[model samples]
Target: MDIKLWQAIIYIVLALIIGAAAGFFIARAWFKNYLKKNPPVNERMIREMMRQMGRTPSEKQVRQVMSSMNQVK
Candidate 1:
């Protein structure tokens, strides 16, 4: 009877662990999709950032930075 009880506990623990693992992956995928759909940073932000650093951004410079940023992702 003791062995049976321990076996049941192990099964429940295993199920809980598996469920947590699945949730982590699912949440990660959802977050990735959300970020892709609504990017936090845009060209304007990059331009502003450059300006803050004492550099005036030309359109071409902004475009290059934007392309490189996207490529890094």
Candidate 2:
């Protein structure tokens, strides 16, 4: 193979690597932001969890749990 062909191959490989890394980070950041804005667990889910644990959650209890969870974010 010619020297030019080798150089072209190296450049293409480098570009692919850089693109993959950048895309990975961007996708990860977007997912994190999406989850933050739309939390996976809501009031109903929390109530269900408490019920599973054998306790019926009250409005105050649910609100407290929500506040604590949001504070962590």
Best by lDDT: 2
Instruction: Quote the positional error of residue 20 for candidate 1 in Å.
Output: 0.8
Show the colliding residue pairs in model 1: none
lDDT of each: 0.96, 0.96
Write the residue-wise lDDT of candidate 1 on 1-73 in tens digits. Answer: 9999999999999999999999999999999999999978899999999999999999999999989988999
* Count: clashes, candidate 2: 0
Residue pairs with clashing backbones, model 2: none
Best by TM-score: 2
**Clash counts for the predictions, in order:** 0, 0
Expressed as tens digits, the lDDT of each residue in 3-72 for candidate 2 is 9999999999999999999999999999999999997889999999999999999999999999999999
- How close is every model to the real structure, measured as TM-score? 0.57, 0.57
* lDDT of candidate model 1 versus the reference: 0.96
Candidate 2: residue 30 Cα off by (Å): 0.4
